[model samples]
Target: MTTPRYKRILLKLSGEALMGDQGFGISPSMIKYVAREIRSITDIGCEVAVVVGGGNIFRGIAASSYNMDRASADHMGMLATVINSLALQDALEHSGVQTRVQTAISMHEVAEPYILRRAVRHLEKGRVVIFAAGTGNPYFTTDTAAVLRAQEIHAEMLMKATKVDGLYDSDPAINENAAFIKHISYMSVLERQLKVMDMTAISLAMDNDLPLVVFNLSDEGSMLRVVCGESVGSRIDNVTDGKNRVDRTAAVSESYH
Candidate 1:
């Protein structure tokens, strides 16, 4: 297998990944497992940063089905990330990794506010910094926050750890015959509206030339696979203002098959 191409990577993990097989909230065993994977990456010489989503506990926008105010709902979502970040910090520490949880919204009791320089300093010192609170504002998903933070920290790539292995032409879970694209362009992603991520997030990543490595976090060694430059999932990078570019040296296919 080919090695991972990135030196400093910002991993964007959805809260649902922490849920494991549970219906809601985090599973201790699962968190520990994920933390171990991250530890493996850091053990190699790569600086790892994380932007965790709070979807498992709450997604303010998705909660519109209940008619909650969009801003209030988003704030609640931010709070949920704080909870998740704390859990992850504890888990990482348990695995012998020093971590710091930084939030956009100030919660001095639990973590430091999201200060870009401070977070970068932590990474420089070899500490895993968990960015929480989704940009410290409402009406934005954590996906956008991930792009913004990843860009600000000058992360070489964004390792998007999702339930799915990679971007697909159709819903792989629902459509058995869906095919995964080994490589795709930004125009293709938007022209098709593939729903890999929001336009704002993708645009930001595109402008900054930050690659998005979409992979499955549920697997045992996916995180290491991403760090080691192995063929594990789909990578989005604008070759010429592109969106998601697959690694040419590795098996860059999605698991929709």
Candidate 2:
């Protein structure tokens, strides 16, 4: 048995992750696999909340290149997030994991509206809350929404699931020799211009003294390892205006296999 580092955590999954190896659209197999991984965490008694992105279907900022209205495009992207949320909800329930989808915009027909206090109660009862629709506002990315929800829920940490295993000084796939950061300081990440999250999201996390851990969700058990007191990838914490900061390398172990 192992003690957990964070009792409750907000896991942010990009819509692209749901796409998996299919290259486009939701990959049924991949969603189930990911849901199983999430189930493993809940089985261990850690409350988990997920904030999903809509980039897989559409991206508001990307459409700005064309004649699309920025606000309208962003709203469309938000709707895309709801689609992903329902997909995840179905997959998770099929895996026998209790799940809930809450949107920033009130769409009671599809899912519950985002109510911070209510979401916290859901967690207390061991339900996984999926926050979709990206803050129900334009110009705010899902990354920022994750930060906001993590704060409102008083989450112990934020787990950002990315294509890469952790944060790197440069692009990992393009740069084979790029160094992977097992841990980094929040201020340093901002000062040195590391691409973890957007400035707004980073600022919120910094102000709240919330540690954000980056890891590869493609790998099995990575999320579990982080919550159960295992350092998987780069942990960004400690800011000049916030709490103390430190960095260290984490060896691969059961912290998550």
Candidate 3:
């Protein structure tokens, strides 16, 4: 049994990651896969907290571009996150992992209101806590919410699970020559305007010196490997050891299913 590098971590999942091969909505298989991945780490005694995005169902920013009220669109988006959160909780429970759903916005009928101490307590008792509703406010992405919750819970690291292997200089889909970054500095990420996360989230993590790992969730056991500190993805921190450049030769492609 390998000792985990971080006792506690915040795992951030994009709504898009739940869509699988479908164009919209959550894929049952994908959600289950995510649950199992989380369970793998939790079984090793690593406390887990999740922050999932809602872009698969609704994107407030995209709506706002088409004459919709930004706040209203964002509110809808937040609700979408809650939906995902509930689905995730159900799947986690089915996987034999005790789970809790806490929403930033008050909605006691379904989940507990986002109470910092209570959420921490749940994690301390070996329960996986899924944070939903995205900060209970508009204009903030789930990325920011993940960072905020991680800080409040004192997570050792923020692990962002994505479809791709790691951070890249440009969108790999569009740019054939895009380079894969193995490691980077938060400030450099901001300067380059990388899309690993929103600027606000990156800035907050940088300010608090929170380490971030961007890895491919589609790869089996990738999450567990990351928890064991196995260099499974690109890492972003405050260090600048001249190792921030991308490795154009390194690329990984794996099927989600």
Candidate 4:
């Protein structure tokens, strides 16, 4: 059996990833696909915890931009995360992976309240723990919540699942001339004002020196490859040896598959 790179990891999934080809809301097929991907890692004895966003259902920042109260909008966004969490829980359970949903906001009826010790216990028992509700506070994003939970659980690494194969100098979707960055320092990301993560989340991860891997979720076996220590995504950390060096040549020549 191939040994996994990290014993424990935190995966951050954007709510938009759950939508698949749909215009809005959760897509059952996407959730099931994610469940299978997660199960692959667990089958190899890797402990996994996830933080899912709710942008597909509701985006607090966008709402606030349209004249809604910021706090109320954020709270509503948190609830959207809860809904995503439940859907994920159901999918995981159906896939035969034991799962638990922990909410930052207290809602005992739907899930257990966020308790550090219990969450650790659940992972120790081989169950995947899904954190929802975005830190139970207003003005915070799921990105920040993922970092906080990862630090609290002492995860070996943080994995961010995105649509892009890796981090690029510019949006690869529109700019074909963008350069691919294989590795970057957290400070470089912040200084360059990259969209890898929100400033608060990047700052928090930087302060704690938590390594983050951003990869394409749509690619089959991408998560498994990442867990197995393959160069499956762009990595961000404190390493300064070759930080901020863009790979324009690799961008055109290398294939993620």
Candidate lDDT scores, in order, read: 0.82, 0.85, 0.92, 0.92
- Would you list the rank order by TM-score, best first? 3, 4, 2, 1
Which pairs of residues clash in candidate 1, taking residues 3 or more apart in a chain or in different chains? 3-228, 3-229, 4-228, 4-229, 186-243, 236-244, 236-245, 237-245, 238-242
- Top-scoring candidate (lDDT): 3
Candidate 4 deviant stretches above 4 angstroms: 249-257
Global local distance difference test of model 2 = 0.85
* Candidate 1 residue lDDT tens string, 1-257: 34456778898888888888898999989999989999988877678889888988998888876898888899999999989989999999999999999999988988998888999999988899999998998878888999999988888888888777688777666666666665676657777777777888888887787888778787778888777778777767665655444332322233332
Clashes of each: 9, 1, 0, 0
Residue clash pairs of candidate 4? none
Shift of residue 179 alpha carbon in model 1, Å: 0.8
lDDT of 2 by residue, 8-31 (tens): 999998888888777677999988
TM-scores of the candidates in the order shown: 0.90, 0.91, 0.96, 0.95
Report the Cα lDDT for residue 194, model 4.
85
Query: Residue 71 in candidate 1 has what lDDT?
Result: 87
Superposed model 1: Cα runs more than 4 Å off: 1-4, 240-257
Candidate 3 lDDT by residue in tens digits, 1-257: 76898999999999999998899999999999999999999999999999999999999999999999999999999999999999999999999999999999999999999999999999999999999999999999999999999999999999999888889888776666778898899999999999989999999999999999999988899999999989888899987675586778544443221
Query: In model 4, how large is the Cα lDDT of residue 73?
Result: 98
